[model samples]
Target: MRQVIPLGTVTMTYPGPVREQPLAIELHNTLYAADGEPLDGLADERGLRAWLGAVRGRLPAQARGADPRRLADVRRLRDAVREVLHAATEQRPPRPSAVRAVNDASRRCPSSPQLGAARGGGMRAAIDHHGADATDIALGAFAVDAIDLVTGARRGALGRCGAPGCVLMFLRDHPRRAWCSPACGNRARQARHYRRTHP
Candidate 1:
């Protein structure tokens, strides 16, 4: 049976859009499962372009001018990010190649922050890309975010969705957040209930 969750006025399926997570986690979640089959959110050049536009706010690089030819680069970076995150969550060593890939991407195009006094007493900042284009800067920013997420303060909060057949990774933003979303939580509860009654 398919799991359907009705939250107040709207009804949602078992797997829903996994959002509000960090950029790197979102990248890792590009490969997710639906109805027993894996779906790549970045399966094509057009899809990649759309995904980049969706996350433009969080990325240092602008999305509108991204080259369609950079789709392969994004896919490779996402794969490497997923590999490292899997290893981190499992408390094992990641593949050396994965580590190298992330590092290389992080250094692909470096940016420097320029800070100055704001209107009052605070400070304002802007990024200086040093002539690099949008695509390279975006890739480097994504890799840098992955590095910080896996090795920084919130590293302990990295986790995978526990709902059955779900392969999305999420950062533990809430203390009691076990699944990636409310839909997943409801599905898990429904599964447990089914097992208790059917067995």
Candidate 2:
């Protein structure tokens, strides 16, 4: 027989989108969370590799044979991206170090667009890269997206989930949308209802 796990008892896996947002934003959200509970997705090299494997197309290659130092670097980059996003959401200037971190990562693995011949004799658009490894390529993509997110017009759409104890950020795709996901929305509404009925 299968054993059932009780709610709030199991250590949940990553709890956010995989490809819904830019890869950089997704990386920033790897902090699995609930009110007063935050779980780090990149807790170790194994965990980082697992996440990278799950999001196959996001990275040019798998982060195989990652060591503790490499995993720490990835986490550091993620924190920098999160800092930039937070500043953008608040309409404040991003920290100079955060900007530098993203720029540095982007420089490590720059992707250039090129026109290559297709199988049927037509030219197709493709991205060419420099001497970048899997981590560099992935971090470079995130850096590019984070730059756009902070400087582009869509910066106004940056939002943090209003649900109590939940710390997720997202782009507000439409008006009247508040929480990062439907589950968070329901939780917020239920909390409000409970407060009203109890009072």
In model 1, the clashing pairs are: none
TM-score, every prediction: 0.86, 0.83
* Residue lDDT tens for model 1, 1-199: 2234443364544332438688888888878888778888788875665566566567764433667588898899999999999999999989999999999887877778999889889999987775667777787777888899889998999989999989998888887788987888999999999999999
The candidate scoring highest on TM-score is 1
Off by over 4 Å in 2: 1-19, 61-69, 119-122
Task: Please report, in order, the local distance difference test score of every candidate based on alpha carbons.
Answer: 0.79, 0.73
Q: Which candidate has the top score in lDDT?
A: 1
Tell me the spans in candidate 1 whose CA falls farther than 4 Å from its real position.
1-18, 61-64
The TM-score between candidate 2 and the true structure equals 0.83
Model 1 compared with the native: what TM-score?
Answer: 0.86
